[model samples]
Target: MPHFCRIVKSGIAAPLLAATLLLLPPAAQADHADWHHGLSLIDKLKYAPDFPHYDYVNPEAPKGGDVKLSTTGTFDTFNPVLDKGQPAVGLALVFDTLLKSADDEISTGYGLLAEGVSYPADISSATFRLRQEAKWADGKPVTPEDVVFSLDRSKELDPLYANYYKHVTSAEKTGERDVTFHFDQKNNRELPNILGQLQILPKHWWEGQGPDGKPRDITKTTLEPVMGSGPYKIAAFSAGASVRYELRDDYWGKSLNVNVGQNNFGSISYTFFGDRDVEFEAFRSGNSDYWLENIAARWATGYDFPAVKDGRVKRESLPNPLRATGVMQALVPNMRRAPFNDERVRQALNFTLDFEEMNRTVFYNAYTRVDSYFWNTDLASSGLPQDAELAILEEVKDKVPPEVFTAPYKNPVGGTPQAGRDNLRRAIALLKEAGFELKGNRMVEAKTGKPFSFEILLSSDTLERVALPYAQNLKKIGIDARVRTVDASQYTNRTRAFDYDMTWIVWAQTLSPGNEQLDYWGSRSATEQGSRNYAGIADPGVDALINKVIFAKDRDTLVAATKALDRVLLAHNYVVPLYYKRDMNIAYWDKFSRPAELPTYAIGFPTIWWSKNASPK
Candidate 1:
């Protein structure tokens, strides 16, 4: 779960969980007495109630001109909340949440649509007072009724939101301009903050008929441009090829503190290409204005074009100051599948991955091995569990692997041929202990005499570079590992259905880990379709630990619980840990200008940026 502040991505769903408890501290009780301008999950907010704008933005920055961008896959829907189709990339620009997050803060939200929010110290419920000035794109005032409707509809329509807000029993319009959400539990501090992340929908527009006279359905994907309250509106679109958003002159909240210097582009367009290589060519030819390089090979040596050398283009490797770039991108073996269910077999798979060699050869030594699920963070497990973390792990000591206590988890090293051979030998031993033996050139199960073979499912041709090497390595151990590349749509559907033997899974972590942990590793999500549990992990110990992290009373306990969970996850060997780079590789044509100070957590593109050459109004 990427720490998406306001807008939820098209195919990727957000987080959710349920708990039952009641009791609020004195501090929480006092907070409910008066409405606050913002909410923070852990620390005090950096910005004061009357702060003019975020420090990262230029409040007087000029805004105009058009920007062209690119997306790898196609999109069929403008409706972002639906899970069925690929929603347009810039669809998030059209909506406004009750509260908006500041990029500099880890887990804090300032008032956006709402003027202020309040919750009792007991935290039984949170009440939000909507700003009378806030209006929909259709010019209708945003009401408490619309907020209530949006909450109810989201919980009813999307499984992701359903599970995320399961603890919230009801959302009702308690006053003319105020709406309250009642939670089933107390001390679950993240509830109010997470609720602030909700993208409020216009109840009237959703219930009304479309231009074709058919009733609009929020649950279904549609090509029709919907009404939104944000700065941009849908200008033009082709079903699956492209979409354009034009800034609205009558847009509400354009003068708000949060909106002071953001949404700079007069028009923003995104073109979709089937192949990444072709996309790069388009970018090189100046068809696109910006490109975020994810491929190391391209970043290392692919940007020697004439334009780059002539000063028309700029390439940079900016340091990512937001969150850890240590995402767990790896070969996730589906635990529901045979052989993968065995702990020893999973361990053998991890041993066969020669990341050290791959980093040198394929990645040009530009990456480092990811050792922890919470990699590059203080929350990651280190030398040994102690104090609070040890006490938490002790509760699950009997359930988790014993090595978690005795040793620090480490991936098998293999930079030299001799090291590779040694690692292969160790993998073979583990497989044999799991009741598998090599007969001739094939490895077969000892009891059933079944040959071991599986497909490494890939969504893009680029992944073949990584998968092919691993498959060749597996072949050396007498295991038939086939690499299959499917189209983007098919890959999305199949992965959502958990219909694969092995696939690349990237689980990005946030500094404030909370309910989202359940969606990533909880038992219930393991079997649930459209859930983020890509590996099908259903361990009871993992489930309990996730709960511990969620219901943690303070930041210290949350960190401890998260580290303990990390230790257990690494011991399981559920994934062949891949590699990550610390810096973000970015390249763009020098047509746009941005703030001197970038947001701590994000690039703040399009938003908080403007055209260097803008026409006077």
Candidate 2:
């Protein structure tokens, strides 16, 4: 859910996470020893408890080689708990969660740090039995105190953590290796699985003095490499220039069921570049081993290199048809501001956007217009809301827009000059009805004579191609639209404070979306600083619909409620929907070998892919 300013996402292929803030093991079924090892919400656990390794992994895969990846900006802090500095990629490599989620399964996970877990029938509280083998880099045992400290510290430091784990009321060390998390509410199905994903921090090291002899504050950002208990540790670094990790031979979980053929790299490294183009060039030059291509034009035309032509570089479009990604990549309008706060003004902005023209011109026609908040999923509403979806909407019919019942939500089409003019007239008419007037070829507020204008804030100039044309369209309708590009930090800060008139925001959603819906669109989070509610949505109907989604009894109920919510959100023009890619476009040097099968939802890159340079035994 946009990471609430902490994790600025760049990869479109990054999944709508199973858990909102972190990846987690699947949900547990009941309170028992058998249920301790694995969990599932709606379906049977895919892999048995005694399974040796994930089916998508090479159970006997070789484990040695170094691979370099590319990053655009510098990373200042190694501390991932704070919202301050950009946390480096592969931070997860250094830490471990209680349970690990299998890639192919949508709602199942197995024990990792925790050997077993127990929860109440109602799922009010969950107890995790820590593996005695788990140890920090310095050989200190991972304890229940560490788990308690991790939860309290993370919630205190990161807003995303605070929001994600808000339902977790308290954590306590119940036994020698048992840490139990108590929930504030009952029958909230996703809590056990979410709590299992709590990234356990080493309490002793964090509370102690650092190399500077200063007591470390988890709330503040730091460059000091964190002490962790995972498969790899920070071996070398030059701040943002580059960072390398050495896989630990002494790693505690090396022989576990989940770790059988994973973390096979002897070393993994990342090099910083000026931009994505430079990064791609680095990959083409064999400096980095892998690349995820997002630029449509580059993918369609730029891969004429000799390596690609001769098959030295492998390119694959990995498509998972069953994956349901609820992604909204759009221009988010801050409703707290004027003109945007008015429905007519917001609707007018949508009419000004000629997606078909923009798709052909800027995006190389490689994208599908995002039609729903839950697009590319069964949850996306179409035509008229019928049956269950209709029933759900009827409860809030008065609270939502009247057109929701009378009209289907469809973005205006404009590729031809005639269609463009038609859409332009529609936009002007909406503005006129909203007390705006086109005087001397410029729209001004009828009450105060202020020009209909606002800035389109962007983090990178890559978006200018899209925003500039949109700005031109707005100007054509006698509205003054300005475009501004700033650094990622400034863009994040401004958006966090709700200071921007409009900006690019993406809210990635999972197939099983729950609790986090509150942080996404709840009225309470609208004013809350560091919320995923970037557009400041606070409609009563939205609030009611979100609650319905959160409390959905079964899968059918969840889908219907989500579709109803989508309809209401579309009815209001909070975001000018943009384009989205359905599949992952990836290219890599032919120096590595992955399992014959890959994870269902993700590409299983460096994590599950092993280097082919290792000697066969």
Candidate 3:
């Protein structure tokens, strides 16, 4: 989510999808179909009657060509646990999950590494059957031992590496190629998505000590590429530089159902660029074959290249369904900080935001305003409040006060800001009562005599442009605020330490949302090294609700707990929800093509990509 604006050197490559291919009508002057045109019919032939539902798994799929692909980031290491970017991309080619998320349905996985996922009816612990097919890049068989080693190391590793495995309680080897995972509880629909994130590593290769003579923390030792079971193994790696993943000619999972016709590219090489403009120029001139444009100006307009007119490059602007529809980017207040500790102050700050002006002027009309936590999607909360949430608010009306909920949450320009103003006025009164006063229009604490001025941090020029408008509005509300622009390197460190007063960022939630709802908004995650609590929240009630949702074994109970938590967060105004943009700006070469019809979920680039010809090596 932090990379929403910052250009990354890694991510899934958008498929070279050919959208809306022509299917000629029959009424063409009593047309006689020519032999050349008849071949097009063969292109749409069904070779397997039983497998008729397969979308892109054409047995006739042409092979033998090396598809050159490029993403924004480099895969500098082979250790799946250590490297987040390139390893994630590379793992897709080499390893297999216990269960495959095939077209939104859970399916029995083919054994490249795993044969099947076993769960008892009560579902407390699940066992994974490893295929004899699984092997390291060096051809050593992958076993249950490797699975156990990886999971154990992940749980014991430093916060940076362990954060991803926060919920996995423990992993154990039950047999040669069989492993069992004991969850803290049962019934998580996200089990499939979580499994997909795992990448099998070679346990034996990493067993030795490092140069320091101490047990190596796999994450920090980035000297070599990781040995994995994926289609490609690390060919070469340059620290903080470039990485090359060469195809494993003897790949174990080559013919698996989930991998069939996937990872077709012979090799993928990723190179990093500190400057996005430089990266865009490389993409235009063929130095870089692929890159996604984040600047709205480039997407709404056209690429400034001769190849576009010559038909060598194709650009498709499609709607993204997987992204968070409600607040992709948000303005979060630091609840741990004083003055902001009060609910009225937080609500007032949310009201003070002028999203309409920001969207139009700053974003160049590239975004839409979002009122609820879920912006444009069906998952976003409607105007109707959840019964439990409303009930909780009713009970707390006396102690913490209920105007925070009674006040109509409105966008200042479209709806009335009375609730916002009333809240702000109350904030002013409370501050005065707390022995603070408006000195020359800026709120100043009487005790410390410190002005209520804070800085907001962001990583991109685009965000800088948008944040300036929000800062100006805060200035009008007697708060002195300024936008702090930092390079990607500095920005990442500051955010990791929760170093800023206020920040603008987003989170990518899973489709079948789970207990991470707790991690994002719960009190326990507030101070963790890698927590998403940008607000520094520590409310016990919010924490209790989050835990309830996380441990809920039934869907209805999970939904009820989550909805209640969402309202509690809304009441606190820990985060000011911004608009979610439906349209995504994607630009690529026309030579790449994909199946005519795209899956509703895979409309974005990576899932739909296929190259018509090889890219420059």
Report the CA-based lDDT of candidate 2 relative to the real structure.
0.81
Give the alpha-carbon lDDT of every model.
0.81, 0.81, 0.54
Candidate 2 stretches with Cα past 4 Å from truth are 1-13, 19-35
- TM-score of every candidate relative to the true structure: 0.95, 0.95, 0.79
Error of 3 at 10 (Å): 14
- Could you report the Cα RMSD, in angstroms, for every candidate shown? 3.1, 2.8, 10.6
Q: In candidate 2, what residue range of length 10 has the lowest lDDT sum? A: 1-10
lDDT ranking, high to low: 2, 1, 3
lDDT tens digits, residues 504-537, model 1?
Answer: 8777676677777787788988888777788889
Error of 3 at 4 (Å): 17
TM-score of 3: 0.79
Which candidate would rank higher by TM-score, 2 or 3? Answer: 2
Report clash pairs, candidate 2.
26-108, 26-109, 27-39, 27-40
TM-score of 2: 0.95
Model 3 lDDT tens row, 57-159: 4323433333333433333344545423234243444444443333222111222356644455444555666777767767888888888776777556534
Clashes of 3: 23
